[model samples]
Target: MAVLAIDIGGTKCAVALTDASGDILTSEVAPTPSGGDAETLWRALWSLIETTVGAEPVDGVGVGCGGPMTWPDGVVAPLNMPGWRDGFPVVARLRERFPGVPVRIHNDAIALAAAEHWKGAGQGVDDMIGMVVSTGVGGGLILGGRLINGGTGNAGHIGHIVVDPAGPPCGCGGNGCLEAVARGPALAAWAVEQGWVPGTPAAGPVNPELSEREAAALYRENARATGRQLATDAAAGDQIAVAAMNRAGWALGLAIASATHLCDVDLVTIGGGLSQSGPLLFEPLEETLRTHARMGFSSRVRVVPAALGQEAGLIGAAALIVGGDRYWSP
Candidate 1:
């Protein structure tokens, strides 16, 4: 029997039909509704779900979502997707849509951790952390071969960990959180503050043409453009871009090292759009890890890129139903 897998994010919603072995039979994606309300977002997700599995029937459904959520109950108030701040009754809706099929919900990062443990970087590892660093930073942990979902299902939320007490403010209302320093927007804003101008495709080898006013407008309007474009610049040897990425990597490495000090996880698998920046990010990350990890065991922990890539969350959702035996341990 196939499992219907759903992944909801701030920018998009994805649905997939997968069998027990993690093969995706069908999949679909849609931009998140621009209205940013619960009903509008649900409409987009419902459309993707129907398009992906309308004719095909599935035995069960599993959902992965970014969260301030209640698992099993499947209610969510994802910080990135404020439309559901009042809390979304996701499991109830899925149950109503697919009557009699088992339905379960997981924090997206936790789901990714489970998927990684089953088939990706954490395979065969008894203790691990899975992290996604893109528009935001998020994480999940597996220790003693059991997925740790804390009292409110928010365990392993490493993003909000305070790293710099005097650093910038975070959306979570904290100061100097890992998310505040290392997320894409933070990196871009830092680069911009240091006078990095975004190069345009049309500008060729010439410096960016935009006046300061025009550049600031672009920066304000397109928050992610800075980080994405800066990655390109860093690859081509732009000093400021490299510095921005280096700072981000250092902050992330510090956070991971701190977490390792506490959990002593054997591995940390990073998956996210930012991870694609490759050595421009990872080099500094490794340096920081080596510099900050004081304990012998913490220094031994391996940090690697996630193998399943973009499909980790979808596969993880499906895994909740198809491979629970492989992941769950008392």
Candidate 2:
């Protein structure tokens, strides 16, 4: 069966057409209309969907969107997407557009977990956690060979797990949350505050002669100091950048240790822009995890980078329909 998959995030929105095995047949991506109102953003996304799907009939539609949403209902108010902070009825609109086909929506992080378990890093593992440490930190859990949707459908939300009692304030109106310290922008900001200068940007506007892809790359490079730049600097041996990575890694390990103890999960698959930092991040994370996760069961847990890379979100979204009740319920 053909399924329509949508992945919505602050930086970009992607749509894909996939078969039963979650292999994408066709896909499209565009920068998110983050500065626009909800209606404008939705219209843009719908246009992308229409263009990608064309006249092909999909059997079901599934969406993975950033969270703090009312799930099953799919009323989203993703913290990073300011335009949708008031909440958008994504599932209702998808149902309206697709009619008889089943429509499913879940936290993007949860979708990532489902994707990993279905076809990626956690494929053979019955209990694991999938985490994204990019624009923000988020996670989803699988246990006993099935996805776990807690009371509010927000169960494996590890981003808000506190790693330090006296750390920075978080966007969730709490202090010392893991997201507050480890999210890309937050980590970069922390690095800047500690006197680390990010990569220098070209002085002029993106050259009109450049290809669309090149121009987009230039624009992003010029926009702000982000976790990507921090990683670059760390690789170049910048002390403050190294320190920032260590801090983020340490925080991630602490939170993971807590999650291991709580859920008894044995594997963690991490993805997203920041995870690209390679060993600079994972080494400290491993060291810290070993320090705190000393219990017999938790000690065996392993953390690894996600195997599906950028397509994981879309694949996971498709799994909501393709995998049937194994990854989706209500």
Candidate 3:
């Protein structure tokens, strides 16, 4: 049987119709509505679902959404998508469109976490954290063989965890959060403020102020300091690029260390565009973990890059429809 999945984001929505094994049969993409994100997003999703399910029977529907969500209950308050404050009637809307089909919805990060456990980097691990450090930072946690869905369904809002009490302000109205310090656009903005980057992208409610590709490229080009280098095949020997990566890694490690102490979760699967820096970030993270995490259990946590790339969100969303709570464990 084929399952149709839709991943909803502030800017874009991806639709995929796949089989029981999670093999894609049909796919579509649409821009999210700016002024009326919920309505526009739902409309796009409906269109995509209709197109994919046409002539082809589907087993179920899964929805992967952004954070500040009320899962199973079907509501979300994704800060990035400002037009939506209360919640989106995803379940009701999906039911209206495809009556009897079972539909499950979860935060995108949670869905991606499920995918990681099922088929991606966290394949064998019973306990793990899947994180997306993109234009924004989001995370999902699996504990004791079940998806950890809290009261608000935002159990794993790792980005908002205050890493630095004195750091820059975050959209969530906090200071020095991991999201403020290391999210894609935030990092790029930091770079631009320091004269590392020349231009700033528009900061609309829909778009952030950084470029993943551009930031990665810069990491390779301006390997000027011990803590700032563009990761590149050419700059493999450059000390600056190495340093920048180490700084990023250190930040990641520090946060993970804190999480390890709190949750006792030792395995973290890092995904998203920023993690593509790979060793540049991971190496420092390893070092930081060794220096920081005081508890023996915290030190033993294994931090690995996510095996699945962009496909993680879409695939994990589909897995949410069937896996129930067996996705990840701690």
- Residues 272-302 of candidate 3: C-alpha lDDT, one tens digit per residue: 7777777667777888877888777777788
**Number of the top candidate by lDDT?**
2
Misplaced by over 4 Å in model 2 are 200-224
lDDT of each structure?
Answer: 0.84, 0.90, 0.72
Candidate 3 weakest lDDT stretch, 10 residues:
198-207
Ranking by TM-score: 2, 1, 3
Say which prediction, candidate 1 or candidate 3, comes out ahead on lDDT: 1
**Against the hidden true structure, what lDDT does model 1 obtain?**
0.84
Q: Candidate 2, residues 250-305: lDDT per residue as tens digits? A: 99999999999999998999998889999999999999999999999999999999
Per-prediction TM-score to the true structure, in the order listed:
0.89, 0.91, 0.82
RMSD in angstroms, all models?
3.7, 5.3, 7.1
Off by over 4 Å in 3: 33-38, 82-86, 198-244, 327-330
Compute the lDDT for candidate 3. Answer: 0.72
What's the residue-level lDDT of 43 in candidate 1? 82
* Residue 140's lDDT in candidate 1: 85
- Residue 192 of model 3: what lDDT? 45
